[model samples]
Target: MEGELQRRVGRNLRAYRQERGLSQEAFADVLDVHRTYMGGLERGERNLTLRSLEKLAAQLELDPLELLTERRER
Candidate 1:
């Protein structure tokens, strides 16, 4: 369940970043994190802290809960 949630968050993050036309490296810079770390996050290989998740959502102008919720196709 934990892993599934992580991947869901990663997918949401990736979608948001892509929607803003930002690359992983650029997004990482905005988040003050390493590009490799961003890649890990997007790939769901790294676990994110609650604080970090909030920070990411804030940067994307999103509610933190949005990052956790799964997205469905319209």
Candidate 2:
């Protein structure tokens, strides 16, 4: 279940980033994380801490809940 949440968050994060015209490498740079690490997050292979989530949300100009939202059609 946790893994599933990761995937959902990752998918949403990717969408949000792309919508803002940011590449994974560029976003990673903004987050001060390695590009590979950013990829892992986008692929749902890495878990993010609350601090990381907050930072990312700040960068994206969104609320943290926006990142966690599971927008996939049921």
Candidate 3:
């Protein structure tokens, strides 16, 4: 379940980044994370902590719940 959730969150992050037309480097800067870490996050290879999620949502202008949910952009 954790793996699946991670994958979904990774997909959501990629989708949101694409929607905003931001490169991973730019997005990592905005999120205050290393580019490699962001890559891992997007690849579902890392388990993000709650604090990490909060920080990411704050940077991304999204609610925390948005990160927890997986829905294709409309």
Candidate 4:
């Protein structure tokens, strides 16, 4: 369901954000979204729109597929 997809995207986003050394608030500011909304996004509680997805991908300088990719366990 969407919940699982959200969680996956959230985890990916978290990893990317951390790799870039951005705090939640700083990331939110860069994305032009509210901090609380960003938190919900990182928690996989928000329903993401195409526009939002593109924005996040653009900010991360990654392809949208990268954001959607689920990390696999060894």
Q: Clashing residue pairs, candidate 4?
A: none
Candidate 2 C-alpha error for residue 46, in Å: 0.7
Q: How far is candidate 3 from the true structure (C-alpha RMSD, Å)?
A: 1.2
> Which candidate, 2 or 4, has the higher lDDT?
4
Quick one: ranking by lDDT, best first?
Answer: 1, 3, 4, 2
Which candidate, 2 or 3, has the higher lDDT? 3
Pick out the ten consecutive residues of candidate 3 with the lowest summed lDDT: 1-10
lDDT of 3 by residue, 1-74 (tens): 65988887788888888888999998888788899998999999989899888888888899988987988558
Superposition error at 14 for model 3 (Å): 0.6
Candidate 1 lDDT over 1-74, as tens digits, reads 65998898888878887887999999899878899999999998878999999988888788999999999853
- Tens-place lDDT per residue, model 4, 46-72, is 989988899889987889988888866
Give the residue spans of candidate 3 off by over 4 A: none
**lDDT by candidate, in order shown:** 0.88, 0.84, 0.86, 0.85
Give the C-alpha miss distance for residue 46 in model 1, angstroms.
Answer: 1.1
Give residue 53's lDDT in candidate 2 (0 to 100): 86
lDDT, candidate 2, at 58: 85
What is the RMSD of candidate 2?
Answer: 2.4
lDDT of 3: 0.86
TM-score of every model? 0.89, 0.82, 0.89, 0.85
